[model samples]
Target: MADKNTQVQLARQPDGEPKVSDFQVAETDIPAAGPGKFLARNIYLSLDPYMRGAISGRHMGHSRLNQGDLIGGRCVAQVIESKHAEYAEGDYIVIESGWQSYCVSDGAAKDGVRKIDPNAGPLSAALGVLGMPGLTAWAGVEKLADPGLGDTFVVTAAAGPVGGTAGQLAKAKGCRAVGIAGSDEKCRIVVEEYGFDACVNYKNDDWEEALKEACPDGIDVYFDNVGGPILDTITQQLNLYGKIILCGLVSQYNRNDDNDFAGHNMGPFVGKRAQLLGLVVYDYYDQMDEFLRAAVPLVKAGRLNFHEDRADRIEDAPAHFAKLMSGQNVGKAMVTIGPESL
Candidate 1:
């Protein structure tokens, strides 16, 4: 066993898009499992846009993190030592292990520890496709929006884990899945890799026109990720009685204050009679088995696809996260902390 644990900690709160200087790396004594807790070695750390708001205390359920505090994140881990009855040594699981190489947890609900299905495509996938991002997509597609055959589904940030997974799920249900992404490369990945029918590069001068061309009948379902003018613009083209899943606000995650978030124009929504649904992934944790049950087979059959961009060390997480926030990462952003197995 290593004598020290490496961690990425907050050095300061970022004003807008994060900078690598905002974070500091440190080494500490590796912690041990207590009577009711288990010690796990983190293998992969999931980097997400929400962490921008989370560290700044702008995101709900998370308080402001102070300097020297470890940045919080989800991780795929292998239990190396255990005193907890439910978790045994050598178990592969996903947990809220933060951005550290090791963590000790009580296997509590708040810790978000979940055993990995060996049949799941890959260990890193537990942090992406078969994990929280996937669950978020599943809940929105299956539980809320529920678009079916002949429905036109449009998603923003389409190259990402949530957007890509949601599009794939909608496609499986026979919906015409179209994606709107930042770059042509991202659009290519969305269409060719994730199997979306078409993708609009929002960076283009005529993306709105492209989106219109893609959804000639008007959009029946809009799985929104980047909210702001794009949301209002998409609402303009929405069909009457359409369903809109307001899944993320990545464009505004770097705002200095809650009041700074872009306000939406309700007039378009009213004209379209849009059924807007807010999605918070935490509410759907219990449905993991249901999601994996459906997702695992699709993965096995090569029907559902996922993409990842990874950093080899925890020290690089801040830079990777900055890239993710700036809309540069091609897929799910991750940092590898240790080997998947001991």
Candidate 2:
């Protein structure tokens, strides 16, 4: 075992879009597992748009990564040394190992530690479709939105893990699933690969018209990720009693303005009597087993398709995260610390 461990730290809070210089890598002595704790060698790191908020210092209270703090994120790790009764050496577990090569943990806190059966699915899936993003999608679509037959459901950032999974779940529940994505390629994958009924390329000038045409009956449920012009367009087309799931506002994550509209229009709230519910996945973490029970079969049967844009090294995390914020990635953005393990 190496004596030193590498970790990515936030050099400073970002002003707008994050740059590589905003982060700095450091090498420190590998931490030893304390009594009732375990030391884990991280294998994969999950990079998400929410992390942008941390770097921007806008949502610092909601994130573990703060100025000069080691960049925090979830990871798939192999236990190298164990002092916990349940976790053993050689066990692969899902943990909040942050943006580092290793982490020390105790199986005491919520989301702090959980053993994963490597044989259940692709280990990486535990970070994407089968992990937090997946649970967020399932909670919003199944538990919150509750789409039904004849309902028209639309999701922004449709090519992303949460949107993609939400659209698939809507389809399975007999609703008309529509997607709004940044590029034609993303739209194609959402429709052709993920079985979405229609996907609108929001990059086009006529995207508003296209989205309107796709859902002739009006949108019954809107799962929003990017809340800018896309949201402005959707708000105008919501049906009576339409439900809006506010999962994210990636379009405004890095914005400096506190009063910026970011495509927000409240006219529909009263006129359509719409229910705009903000989703914080942590609120539903206790339902992990419920989500897994529903998602596992669909994944095994090939009914649900998850797209992953992976970087081979942890050093590439900053670049990949920039791509994600720019809507350049096709699916879940992840960094692989050890590709050989996969």
Candidate 3:
């Protein structure tokens, strides 16, 4: 076992988009499992856009971070030492381990620790497709929108886990799945890999027209991830009585001031009779088993797919996160902390 645990810490709060200088790497004694606690070495750390707001206390239910605090995140880990009854040595689990090599937890529900099923899929996938992002997609598609066969389902951030997965799920339900993405590469990945009907590159000046061409039947369901003027633009194309699942706001996550957020006009929504359902993944934690039961088989069959953009080590987390916030990462962004197995 290593003598020290290497961790990424907050050096300073970011002004707008985060920079590598906002983080510092440090070494500390590897934590020991105390009474009713377990110690696990992290193997994969998930980097998400939400952490940008989380560290700054801009995200819901998150406190502002202080200097020297471990950067908060989720990780796939292996339990090496345990005094807890529910977890034992060699158990593969996902937990709120933050951006570090090792973590100690009391097997608490509040910690969001979940044992892994090696048979389900890749361990790293527990942090991506078959994990929280996938669950969020499932909830939005299955629970809220519930688009009918041949209904038009359009999603933004189409190459991301939530967007890609939502599009695929809607496609499987026989809905025409159209994706709107930032780049042509992302559009290709969403259309070719995730099997969306068509993908529109939002960066193109003619993209909204392209979206209109793709969804000639009219958009019945809109799975929104990036909220901005784009949301308003898309709403103009939504069919009467359409549904909108408000999943994420990546566009506003890096804003240094709240006033920078653009306000939406409700007049259009009132005219369209659109049903806006806000999504918060925390509300669906209990339905994880139900999600995995449906997702695992599709994942194994290659029907549901995912891509990853990863860094070699924990020290790269800040850079990777910066890339994600800048809308540069092509897929799910993560860091490898340790080998999957010892």
Candidate 4:
């Protein structure tokens, strides 16, 4: 029988790189499932760059975690016990269960919890391609940038979950997709697995030249994931009426609060009448059902492909998260909890 009680707690605030000292594995009495609630065993935990923002209290909107409270994010879990009418024992669901091994959920009444179709593909995919990252790519492409057929699209962090999905989505729409990744392997993956038209290695000696050569017609849509020198370079290559979807700034996540970029080259925007727009994935939550309706079929038919770098233990979450921030993860960095068979 499941003990039904126990969890890991945050021990301290991290400075720069997080150490094991920042976390504490603890045991607590599992609270009972209340009216319209269910008990769940966490099977997978999502480790995203946005979690880093939440940890530092830099995220906008309602804070998901307190200083010493359980760190909250998306997780895939199995229902162990239930008082909720919509759920049954052994049902697989996605919820905001934090880093703990178990949780009590009130069905889909809460934000981020949903009954996922386990047969859609791998259950872990509920936290990756077929989940938030996939929706992010769909909304960014369909709503924000709106790349037309044969349009030249450029995306940074091309090997990561959102970027990889975005690149493939662009290709599916008959657009010329160019990806920018940190290493040669990731660049190759973007071209081969994601079907990107071209890939540029940001770490290469002539990255700017390579980008220019690949995008001869200039960039029609720029999906900005890693900002810094790449943003500056992409800004200079915008075609007339080009659009840039600002997804994230992983490149600046570790910067000191004092430092700021100034005097960015805006000449391309002015000359080409291009627009750079910021996009927070949650803003498009209203269209999530629409996105899932479209994307899930592709996933089910094996048309869409995705990758995950799984860390076997929940205790390894912080390290995996650090790797994600450092561009060390090739795809979605997720931590697997409990048994693997689930």
After superposition, candidate 3 runs with Cα above 4 Å error: none
Ranking by lDDT: 3, 1, 2, 4
Q: Which stretches of candidate 4 lie over 4 Å from their true place?
A: 1-6, 62-67, 108-111, 256-263, 340-342
CA lDDT of every candidate: 0.93, 0.86, 0.93, 0.82
In order of TM-score, best first, we have: 3, 1, 2, 4
lDDT of each residue in 232-255, candidate 1, tens digit only: 999999999999999999988888
Off by over 4 Å in 2: 1-3, 63-67, 260-263, 339-342
Instruction: Report residue 301 deviation for candidate 4 (angstroms).
Output: 3.2
Clashing pairs in 1: none
TM-scores for candidates 1 onward, in order = 0.98, 0.94, 0.99, 0.93
Deviation of model 1 at 325, angstroms: 0.8
Q: RMSD, model 1, all Cα superposed?
A: 0.9
State the TM-score for model 3: 0.99
Q: Residues 1-342, candidate 2: write the lDDT tens digits.
A: 556788888887766777787788889889989999888888889998888876555564655356568887899999889998989889998998889998898876744677776766799999999999999999999888998898999999999999999999999999999999989999999999999999998879998899889999999999998777677678889998999999988888777556754345677678989898999898888889888989989998988889999998888888887778777889999999864252
In model 3, the worst 10-residue window by lDDT is 107-116
